[model samples]
Target chain A: MAPLIEVADLRTHFFTDEGVVKAVDGVAFTIPAGKTVCVVGESGSGKSITGRSILNMVPYPGRVLDGAIRWQPDGAPPVDLLALDPKGREIRAIRGKDIALISQEPMAALSPVHTIGNQMIETIRLHLGLTKADARARAAEMLAKVGIPRPKDRLDSYAFELSGGMRQRVCIALAVACGPKLLIADEPTTALDVTTQANILDLFRELRDALGVSILFITHDLGVVAEIADEVVVMYLGQVVEQGRVDDIFHRPLHPYTRALLGSVPRLTRHRPERLPTISGMVPSPFERPSGCLFHPRCDRFEQGLCDRSAPELDRYANDRVARCFKAGAGS
Target chain B: MLTYILRRILFMVPVTLAISLVAFIIIQLPPGDFITALTAQMAENNETLDPETLAALRDRYGFDQPMIVQYWKWITGIVFRGDFGQSFEWSRPVADLIWDRLGLTLIVSFATLVFVWVLAFPIGIYSAVRQYSWGDYIATFFGFIGLAVPNFLLALVLMYLSSRYLGASVGGLFSAEYVNADWSWGRVVDLLNHLWVPVIVLGTGGTAALIRIMRANLLDELKKPYVELARARGLSETRLLLKYPVRVALNPFISTLGWILPTLVSGAVVTAIVLSLPTSGPLLLNALFAQDMYLAGGFILLLSILTLIGTLVSDLLLAWLDPRIRYE
Candidate 1:
């Protein structure tokens, strides 16, 4: 099936006093229908920005300068989100009904003063055009579906009153209340405890299985990526360095940055290295991204002359994978 | 919740007593009692204070007793009999004096409070939502100007301009004909007509400060993840703003009610004198200057009661509005 959403050559830049920071510079990916695509990147890799760009909310002082976000609804012509005005009515219709988001911080993702029921019902009423009673019923139903106990009572509880896990569950419930086509879960489990994280992940898979919603999962945790992702896209310094199926990316990471990321993960069933390997050098500040290949400065397989002089295109690897490097999938 | 309120009320008794005691001590801090002030006035007018008359007056007012005994008598009289004592200057009951002027003072304070919130709310929200826009800049500029101008100076300027250009007497609460007139629709209108001058003068600083505060608080709230989540939920910018960030922002503003009442009343003193308005502010000032102990103490005690009640009301309101505070 065609991808539910296809992002092409997207560039989101933040204009600040220091300089222009190309937060998501020419990065692209897609969320296939009914599948979870995890975009893994460390801090400042533009993973969150990529998720936000799909909703056309890059925030103030930042603009999506060039890109095409073609959202393909079932049996309908693909809508180019980049073409729609960010503040206009058409985008508003697409935002909650078609594409909803579950943010990372559960505590900060819900209004402290408003009850969970009010927030959920208002969104439902606005988009689904349901009456207040119907919206409340739907919200309670969604809450129960997300595994919240005493759904009716939970509705009246404020965000701060709920535990971190419970709050994330409510957030999930609210996001999928309207049966959105795509859910952008930006590190939805990062702030949660390990047990709660597993439970939330299971809930996401169930939601996908039941509702057939496509999910664009953004995170830096390789463990989470391994657990949930059908496909994986590795990002570095605001650019996509590798893209492929999760098994392929994990077992056969081609880009130097991707390989380094995989190497940094702790493993069992083997002798442990005395010092855990990490990707050398910090993420370059957005205002001062390196020329040529952005990751060459920290690449373990850095070529003295070639890797430093010109940027390599994302060329094909075996089994329909892509990587940006002079020597793709050679060493291991 | 009932227990919490009951506990708070119980806690307020000692606090109020302490405040009243301090008010009494401060009233007594000046050189001598009302008798001294009376004698000085008589001396200034070159009239001798006859020794027999002085002794008789001292005995009658219990000035011949020890300071502690006099304080005990005063406290007992107020607590048991609800007597705020006699205003030596006006030779009337202090309660009657405060009661007569309390209505006008409350009207002015209440009007100023409403004016502050009404003007600040929308402007503050606009400044925050459209921060760095021209509207924000203009609102900020005017806010700073309002903060910088003294309330008394503003009162004088407004008084002069209105009297000069409009040929209207905007000084007192009522017109010359309605000054001592009985209640009537015409008198009420005249009172309202002159009410705006003091209200505007007193409200300008608070309105400006509140706008800045509201803008800052909402700006902080607007950056929270909930706001973005709301936006992503496709909540229209207006509804999303009002429902989430503005609601959170209002907490700090509401909590200021306690401080606001006292600040407005105290700040009104100079402006009241400047505009020649017949409010409690001018009466309190004169009482303090003349060492009219009962009148001064009465005014202070009333203000203290208002302060305590304002705090309780704000706390209750905050609990009602915010669930986190309510449960806590």
Candidate 2:
């Protein structure tokens, strides 16, 4: 079957006064139906921007300069999201109905002044074309589905009235309320506590199984990727470096950057290192991006001449895996 | 909320009392009482009053009483019988003089308030949403000009332009013929015709300031995460803006209501003088200048009460609009 959504050569750039910032530079990934694809990267790696670009909600001064986001719903014809007007009705109809987004900061995601029910009902009524009473009923049902107790009373409560964990649950309930086919959760659990994070991840897995929804979960936590993701796409400096089954990427990371990322994860061994192993250099500033490989400056196994002289294409490998490196398939 | 409102209202009692005391003291701070001011004017006109008649005048007006006694009598009269004492300049009751102008004063003040709101709200929203656009630039330019130019100067310039180019008689809420006429449709129409001058002149500065405030406030709100989240919910641009950011941005507008009541009675005093409008502002100014303590003090006390009431109304409105605000 065709993938639920396919992103190819996506290049989202910001036109600032100083220079152009290629935030999501030539990135590609696919989210299959009823599966979770975790896009893992550090801050500014453009994972969030890539997610936003799929919804055509990139903020001002930024544009998807070159890309094709082909969205194929279960029974609907395929449509390239980029071809539609950003503010047009067609894209708007798709945004909350077919695809939904949840952000990291739940406190900021929900409006402080509006009741949770009011916001939920608004989205429900808009997308579902239900009357006020029906939408409200649906909203309460959604709150209950997301494990919020006393869902009827909680609907009237303001965002500030809820705890951080409850607020994120509210966000999740809001995103899945419309029965969207694809949900782009941008670091949804990053701001949560460990226990709450586990609960939320469990909720995500339950929702995916129950609703048969595809998830593009963006995060920097490798453990979270392991817990939730079926497939892993590792990104560095706005480009996807390696992508395969989560186990494959974890056990046999093809790209040097991916190997370094996996190496940095703390282990449960008896011996403890004084300092956790870390990738050497900083992610280069967009304006001062080095020629050839963007990750060469930070890669420990950096080839002095070749890695600096020419960029490596994302090369395909056996067992349905891909890595962007000159030494792909070579021993780590 | 009811308890909160009751508490606020109860709190206003002491506040009103303190304000009345301050107003009386400030009115009295200018050297001499009404009798002395009358004597000074008489001396200026080269007409000397006999000592016996002067003593008799002082006795009749109770000017010979101690300061505390006078204040007590004034407060008791106002509280019990709604009397604001006697205006020394007009030789009439202060209540009578103020009541005559209060109607027109309220009319002009309310009209100016409406005018400022009607002009500022949409323009402010536009300027913020379309920041740096040509429309925003034009509004910002006009807003700055309105802020920089004094109301009296603007009034004078508009008066000149209207009389010179529009060929209309300038100033006052009524034409000469209707100045002393009884209430009639013709008089009401005449009042309406002359109302715009003061309304625009008074509203310009307020409108300008409110526009800037609204723009800045909305700009900040538009950048907030909820606004983007609302957009992601598939709401159209206009609906998303009005429902989220604009609702949040209206706090300042509602808070401005607290000052509107006092401004209704005393705002644009200089402009009222320049235009020769028979509003309470000019009446208060003249009373102050001539040392008509009763008249000036009455105006101040009325304004203070109005301010307290206005503040209460604004607080209630703000609580109603924003769910997060709890009146404790």
Candidate 3:
């Protein structure tokens, strides 16, 4: 059977005044039901772009150029979503009903004028056709499941009255209210403080267990990937450089950029003497993408002629791991 | 919001007082006095300019006193006794003349407003939803024509069309036959038909302007993140765009009340002359030409107050409708 959601060779670009920004270039990933996958990248690495492309929410001047996102509904026909006319596919029907998204900023993400109850009721009614009373009851239940206290009273409160942590919980409740099969959380907990972040992450685990929903999480923090992701896809300059089972990728990483990423992450078990190993230089822009192996200029093992000018495709190695760098396992 | 409104109402008192003082001062600055204009006809008839008769006329009008004393008498008489001195041009009290013309102007102004809003809202929402489509292009194309064709020119075209094709006559609030007839359905119908042309000519430009504002606001509102959330939640286009952001989008257009009185004044002027209706526009123009300061000043004062009230009404409405706003 086809994977529940399959995205292949996706490229999205924004036509800005300076030039066309290759926001997402050649990104590919998949997630099966009852599983979790996380896309890890630095700022401008196209993780968010990849997530937005799945829903075709990328705005004007930035459009999905080349990609196919196929969804095999649990019991429905396999839909080649890219080929489906926007109105014909009713892509929106699948969004809140089957695939929900939580954005980065909770405050901006939540509509200020609406009460939590109002927003939740609107979504539930649209997707489930639940009566107002039934939808309200279910909304409260979902809110409690997301660890919001006093869900009944809090329902009547406007978004402004809620704390950042509570707003995040409300957003999570809104996303999962209809019991969607997949949740696309794009840095959903990034705005919360440490304590709230931990609680929200734990809530995610609990909710996942209760609903059997898959989550395609996107974030820049490696620690978050380690905490919740079952599998990890590392992206750089719109291309996937490494991907594998979480444990394999963490313990026996085979790619240079992945190593640099892991090195830069400040682990709790730290006794730094002089310098924290950092990834030097900036990510290249779309127009100035390196001639070969996009990370070649920034790679520590820079071989002048061999590494700088030759692009390498993804090469699979032992243990079902794939790395794009030519010097994955060998030191330069 | 109620407290804020009350405070604004209280603040208007001092502002109005200052306006009244300025009006009195400017009206006093003219070279010849009111009695001089009053007796000009007698002088034109080659009679002696009688000093004693002029003094008695000035004393009766309270113009014989010093400027500040006369101003004090006028202000007090109006504020305390509800008396605006007689109009030299119309041979009626200033207040009575305003009372008669005020109702006619208001009815026309209000009818025009209703017509414009009703026409603009749906067209604007349509254009925003299918922004570059044929429907939008058609609406915007007609909108450009409406905006570019001055109200006066449109009024002329409408009058010509009605008279030439429909055998109608350009006229006032009601037809000559309807003036003597009782308020029956047929007379009311004829009156409405006569009123329709002026309303359309004046309202078309207003509707076009409002449509542009609504389209821009709706487009901006649709780009907001909350709108995205609404879309992601499977809310239909109708619900998402209209329900979630309608109020946010309307605030700017509604808040644009700062200049509506001037717009109304301009509209009334054009409609009054083009429609040949007896609104204050023609009256004021005639007054200015004949140097009738009493009628002109009173008309200007009434227009100024209407402008202030229009802005106040808009602010009150915005405050009530948008919950996100706070007085503090």
Clashes of each: 0, 0, 0
What are the per-residue Cα lDDT tens digits for candidate 1 across A1-332? Answer: 78888999999999998999888988877778999999999999999999999999998799999999998888479889989988889999988889999999998999988899999999999899999999999999999999999999999988888899999999999999999999999999999999999999999999999999999999999999999999999998888999999999988888888888988888775476667778899988787778789998898788888888899888888887888888888878
Individual DockQ of the candidates?
Answer: 0.85, 0.73, 0.49
Task: Give the per-residue lDDT digits (tens) of candidate 2, residues A174-201.
Answer: 9999999999999999999999999999
Among these predictions, the greatest lDDT belongs to 2
lDDT of each: 0.90, 0.90, 0.81
lDDT, candidate 2, equals: 0.90
Give the number of the best model, judged by DockQ.
1
How close to the true structure is residue A33 of candidate 3, measured as C-alpha lDDT?
77
Count of clashes in candidate 1: 0
Give the per-residue lDDT of model 3 (tens digit) for A159-238: 88888988999999999999898899999889999899898899888888888998999998888888999889999988
Write the residue-wise lDDT of candidate 3 on B129-217 in tens digits: 77889999999999999999988888888888888999978767678877657678987687677778878887898889889888888
Error of 2 at A134 (Å): 1.9
TM-score of each: 0.97, 0.97, 0.87
TM-score of 3: 0.87
RMSD of 1: 1.5
Query: What TM-score against the true chain A does chain A of each candidate get?
Result: 0.97, 0.98, 0.95
